[model samples]
Target: MSPRRRRTEEFTSYYGRPILKEPTWEALDIAGYIFAGGLAGASSILAAGAQHTGRPRLERAAKLTAITAISASVAALVHDLGRPERFLNMLRVAKPTSPMSVGSWILSVYGPLAGASAAADVLGIFPRAGKAAGIGAGIAGSAVATYTAVLVSDTAVPTWHDAHAVMPFVFAGSAAASAGGIGAALSPLAEAGPARRMAIGGAAVETAMSFAMERSGRLSAETFHQGRAGTLLRLSKALTVGGAVGIALGGRSSRAVSAVGGLAVAAGSALLRFGIFEAGRASTLDPKYVVVPQRERLAARQEEPAKADTMG
Candidate 1:
């Protein structure tokens, strides 16, 4: 008789159940929080820059926008929690190893500074204090802009976890783009030149980082190319590209064109955040994603000893 052929066994989960816990965050609340936090963070920096340059209108606009966005983000975050009052517990301890803890502290510090700065601008109180608060807000805002990536990546979600290295760059770029877009839309064309330049640079960085993320060899990269997540991300890319082109060609000449471009960039940033959130959720629903990578890792570990032995 011919030698029996060996059959390869496939890894399987019980009843095909997911091997990982699904994210419990609501799409609207959590994703909105992400967008608003980023916008607020970047806007704070813009406000400080405008202040230094003596652009009163742009400074005022950015300060107000930053305050509003951060307040909204805080509200959204509270609304997302199962126990809203428990949110304060995040501030109880400062754990450098915990991204969530770090983020809470960042927001707490940024919020007061941002609010004080905006209030000072509106009430014309304590010019030096306002400048100091604005400066502090700008510094803290940089942390706020990028720390959300750390928050998400700290989770078990495959796509978010695997993309940790590049996720901060992606978030920072998107934050800058959104802030620039808002600045461009709200400020005069003459006062908005810096915003326009910031938008272009931010969009370029955001687009390149996103492309690199999707091309990374992680299996989770597939999440960006299929399903609802795919559709939104694809639309985000298209809008971002189109908006960048419009800004490049007409940003200097037409306020209307610049406003439209800015709006597009803002919309793209929102969509990208929502899409990433959805993709991470989708990844958890699949057993293969959870099981396969882990199995491969285990196999690789097992092979290491043999390779060491052979080398020795």
Candidate 2:
């Protein structure tokens, strides 16, 4: 065959079948679940910190938010499964290699502790027990905040797989910002100092890591700049940066400023999750993304044999 015909043939596939499996998740369900789960996890930590510091109002608000967010996260996960009963199957075995199984177990532990802590605080009963549960929930929350990153990064999606290292930090920071936003929104300005600071710090960390991921030069990075994902992520970055600035300027002295900043941060966190989900899906849909890297891998393997033969 002529060189031009060979090149053309290389680009074509039978029936134009996709080279990689598209993610079988709905944006509303999976993306929302990721945001809510992160929020719940970080809120548990905030609740524990508030309890330790004797901030009753902040503690109560954080605890309630943790429980509520986790519950909603579970609902979203189940909804994404199409059949709610399939969620139970995940609980049947604990597989270390499977991020979903591990995440399910983490959620199970976190949900009960969060619920009990919130309930005990609300009922004004067993303060010591509630504090202990809050601490446990906080530890579990860390897993929840970061595990979803592992879940996505473990997949075949080029962007997500290449982003394994930074994605966890991004998600964790976003979670902290989201939790802080919720706490700040619920507390008085004077009591919201820590939450505001957390929100700002988290936003800074999240923004830096996200920028790093986008500029890493991986083929998958194209997904972040091309379409709906790009639009949403750009908006997320603007809102996050703007909210952090707002908090830095007036969060401590003005309730209105704190509330607006908090809302912006929370909304940005949600958008980040949705944008990431969309980007991963877009990466899988393009055959070039799946083919080029694999072709390079094969070429590298072929070179290894020739190099060894030459050395011998």
Q: Pick the candidate with the highest TM-score.
A: 1
Superposed model 1: Cα runs more than 4 Å off = 1-11
- Give the C-alpha miss distance for residue 227 in model 1, angstroms: 0.8
User: In candidate 2, what are the lDDT values of residues 182-259, reduced to their tens digit?
Assistant: 888899876777788889998998899999988877767878877999999999999998998998898888888898
Clashing pairs in 2: none
Q: Counting only residues 3 or more apart in sequence or on different chains, how many pairs clash (N, Cα, C under 3 Å) in candidate 1? A: 0
RMSD versus native structure for model 2: 3.4
Q: Rate the local accuracy (lDDT) of all candidates.
A: 0.90, 0.89
TM-score of 2: 0.93
**Candidate 2: where are CA atoms >4 Å away?**
1-12, 304-312
Instruction: Supply every candidate's count of residue pairs whose N, Cα or C atoms clash at under 3 angstroms.
Output: 0, 0
lDDT of 1 by residue, 1-312 (tens): 311111112546899788788988899899999999999999999999999998888899999999999999999999987676768988889999999899999999999999999999999999999999999999999999999999999998998999999999999999999898888888898899888887888889999999999899777888888899999999998888788789889988899999999889989988999999989999888877776777678989999999999999
